[model samples]
Target chain A: MTDRPLDPAVLTPDQARALFRAGLSVPTAGWCAGRTQANLIAVPREHAYDFLLFAQRNPKPCPVLDVTEPGAVSTRVFAGDLRTDLPAYVVYEHGEPVAEVADATEYWRDDLVAFLIGCSFTFENALLGAGVPVRHIEQGRNVPMYRTSRPCRRAGAIGGPLVVSMRPIPAEQVADAVRVTARYPSVHGAPVHVGDPSELGIADLDAPDFGDPVDVRLGEVPVFWACGVTPQAAVMASRPKFAIGHAPGHMAITDARDCDYIVP
Target chain B: MTDRPLDPAVLTPDQARALFRAGLSVPTAGWCAGRTQANLIAVPREHAYDFLLFAQRNPKPCPVLDVTEPGAVSTRVFAGDLRTDLPAYVVYEHGEPVAEVADATEYWRDDLVAFLIGCSFTFENALLGAGVPVRHIEQGRNVPMYRTSRPCRRAGAIGGPLVVSMRPIPAEQVADAVRVTARYPSVHGAPVHVGDPSELGIADLDAPDFGDPVDVRLGEVPVFWACGVTPQAAVMASRPKFAIGHAPGHMAITDARDCDYIVP
Candidate 1:
């Protein structure tokens, strides 16, 4: 397939699923523009309880979109073939990445369950639509994400520190930025912290645990929202026997729009 | 124990826990006036994922307040002893109610985990404060709840219909009612359906599945909000080996106030 900019409007859910299945589309971040893109995770049935509890305990970071039946792929909320829908899959064994593959259909097991977690892209779109500038998007860089000292309450087997993504916003538009993003609670909701990075135990703004760091110019306050990487961190810390997640930027684009997930 | 009207203002968290421990307060709805209360559910660790997914799928009805660590009694958000915090609890054995106990400490196993779900009382207080009269409260009866034809998306072993509570509000106050309740997303968020009972599959407003029927006076529309009974219905349908929940009207009073859960 050629490296052409995909138009989300013309693409059907089946077509999107097919492209993902064939590895034609890579990262789903900007592919389906207005649609709700979800973070993916597959874990053994035994750890489902702890993982779900962890998500519940830290909702802002892990806003669960839908959880599939044990060993089942079809999700009612997303309505897609999880086995072949996503473009890329990262298989983790004992909390370490073992391989990156095009599909998990080959590794399908009866004891594995899939979880679709709300991604920040949904809220980012809302911010952009409301005329609030997202620094990472403008700079053509990945959003800077940091692991904070904030500890997430532990469940049976899952627990870790909260991870947050920073977006530099002008001081004057801070309240507006909050109000716009607050409407989409299903996707990491409002700002978790505003102003200082040092307050969250970060020694430097230039270095992030994941993603690229952007410049924080004059009159800009670094606003932080809970990042989707939190569940991955929890999964790593828990070190389950088996786990699978989407590659860093690769996401599953669902039929539902960003507007559908907004509470208002 | 004497049946004395409990003063909500003067009751400390310890006093409330003690009263509940001694079975002096059977129903906690009106016991503590100014305090926030939570709906309780205790399930074996194995079913935690299903229960958490059930809450996520049915957020309007099962807004989660806090989830406890497996085998642990305290919730970080609520801050209390779960065993003695609630007035009464009903233990279910494979979907059948077997006992109503004052404290769950005896039956508490290391494999049992607890969840504190948001209750509508918080939003009801906000509505009443805004001059929107709550009919059931005025008539001295439990709020009317009904099981709709709407089916909740299945998650693991949990699946059931969406249950909602109805409140009759003057036509002019519908918007105000929505605006006030929308701020409290932790407690059922906004009205799921406004103005019509038939739209929600209720043929007669005079009869309800649970709680007492309220008078729908002239010029008043029956507005419905998802109720906390949804998880109980799901639990009954799934028939897990062991399940525990607070008896209707009996709730766990928390250290957090109603205002604490509200979004600005």
Candidate 2:
């Protein structure tokens, strides 16, 4: 497969799902603009109860949009099979990643239950529209995510530190960004922390635990929002016997509109 | 046990829970007025996924505050044990009510998961404070609830007609009641239907599926809000081998304040 991504900017949800179904693996950052995209997580039916409980306890980091019946193919959020609808899938066995596949057909199992969790794409659009500049978007890079010291409420075997994505904003627009994103609770809600990275036990802004590091210019303060990856981190920490997730950036596109999810 | 309910107006949470725990199996209405009250539903671990899914699918009718760890006695919402803290419990075997007991300690099992679902009591206070008189309160009777033709979003085995509580709102103040109660989404949010009872397939305002019927006076309209009892109705419809629920009007009081759950 070529390294080039098909221009997903103009594709509709149906078209995008079809494209991904054909085994294209690419970041979904700019695809289906104005629509809600989701981070996908799949776990065995036995472990699903714990994962759902974990999401409920830590809603900000794991806003559950839709959950599928065990081994069920389609979800209400997206009318596509979980196994073949994603651009890329990361298979984890006993909490360790074994392969990154375009289609998870080979890894699919009867007891696997898939979950569509809210992603930050919706809020990020709100931020951009509100004129709150996202530094990573400006640099055309993945958002810098950090492993925060703040621990999420534990549920059964799944428990870990809250992971957050940092976006540097002009000090003046910090309140606007918070207010804009706060309207969409299903999509990571509001900034979990602002100003000091040290408060979250994050040492240097240039060094992130995941994703590419973006520079924080003078007069700009770093703002952190709960990331959807927190659930993945929990799954890894717990060392689940079997797990499946969308490769970072290769998210599942949903038919839901971003405006519909806005809480008043 | 006596038929008389304690004068709950002055009792604290701890005192109220203790009263109920000591075998005072009376209706919890008007007791623990300031704190939040919840409808209790307990199901075996094997069927917990469906119950949780049912709540997520029909959040308006089942605003879940907390779910206990399977076979765990206490919950985050209320510190009291699920087995013996409640004054009234309706035990079900294969979906049929087998008995109503003051204490369910004998039926307790390591596999039972109790759910704390939000009730409309919090919003009722808001409605009264907003000067929207609740007719049932005026009549000193239980709120009138009906089984509506409207069906809830089904999840797995749980599917049933929505059950709603009707409050007679003066024609002039129906909108005000909605606005006031709309502020609390954790409760039933806003009115699902206003004015005509026939629209919801409710045959008569005087006949309710549950609770005592309150009269709809000449200039007043029947307002329907999704009731927490809808989940219980669903549970009964699914007919799991074992289930436990609080008898109607007997609720569990929690430490949370009504103001804290206000979305805005």
- Separate clash counts for every candidate: 0, 0
lDDT of residue B8 for candidate 1: 51
**All models: lDDT?**
0.80, 0.84
After superposition of all CA atoms, the RMSD between model 2 and the true structure is 2.3
Give me the candidate number with maximum TM-score: 2
Top candidate (lDDT): 2
Per-residue lDDT of candidate 2, residues A110-181 (tens digit)? 999988888887777778889989777678777788999999999898898899989999999999998998
Per-residue C-alpha lDDT of model 1 across residues A102-179, encoded as one tens digit per residue: 888887789888889888878777787878888876776767889999988787678888989899999988998999
Worst 10 residues of 1 chain A by lDDT: A1-10
- Pairs clashing within candidate 2: none
DockQ of each: 0.58, 0.44
Q: Which stretches of candidate 1 lie over 4 Å from their true place?
A: A6-15, B9-12, B30-34, B101-110, B195-207
Provide chain B TM-scores across all predictions.
Answer: 0.90, 0.94
Per model, how much of the real contact set is kept? 0.53, 0.07
Error of 1 at A71 (Å): 2.4
> For candidate 1, lDDT tens digit of each residue in B134-201?
88878867778888888887876888888898999999999999999988888898988997788888
Model 1's i-RMS, to one decimal, reads 1.9
Query: Could you tell me the fnat of model 2?
Result: 0.07
